[model samples]
Target: MPILTCSIPLLLDDLTELCIAYLRDSLHASNC
Candidate 1:
């Protein structure tokens, strides 16, 4: 249970980072 709790946040953090990166790429594409 404790391991599951710890892994959840790490998974979320990775997902958040991927989302931010995708947003940035889209914004840059729009600017160009």
Candidate 2:
């Protein structure tokens, strides 16, 4: 994985941000 090439913390943060954004979009879609 690219995470193996870069810093662990940075990879984790990036993954976390992606998850949060995905969940937010799902919630909005369900509301509509």
Candidate 3:
């Protein structure tokens, strides 16, 4: 249970980074 708890946040952080990067790329494409 403890291992799962620690890994969840790491996964979430990676996902958040991916989402932000994707959003930035999409916005840049639209502007050009």
Candidate 4:
């Protein structure tokens, strides 16, 4: 349970980064 708790934030951070990158790419593509 402790390991799971620790990994949750790391997983969320990775997901947030992925979402930001995806959004940036989408905006750039639309601009072009």
lDDT score of residue 10 within candidate 3: 62
Q: List the residue pairs that clash in candidate 4.
A: none
Per-residue CA lDDT of model 2 for 1-32, tens digit only, reads 43343434555776767666776887899999
Clash totals for all candidate models = 0, 0, 0, 0
> Which stretch of 10 consecutive residues in model 2 shows the poorest summed lDDT?
1-10
How far does residue 27 in candidate 1 sit from its true spot (Å)?
0.1
Those runs of model 3 whose alpha carbons end farther than 4 Å from true positions after fitting are 1-11
Residue ranges of candidate 2 with Cα displaced over 4 Å: 1-11
lDDT of 1 at 27: 88
Clashing pairs in 3: none
lDDT of 1 by residue, 1-32 (tens): 33345445566776666666776887899999
lDDT of each: 0.65, 0.64, 0.65, 0.65
Give the distance in Å from residue 11's predicted Cα in candidate 4 to where it truly belongs. 6.3
Q: In model 2, how large is the Cα lDDT of residue 30?
A: 100
Residue 29: error of model 3 in Å? 0.2
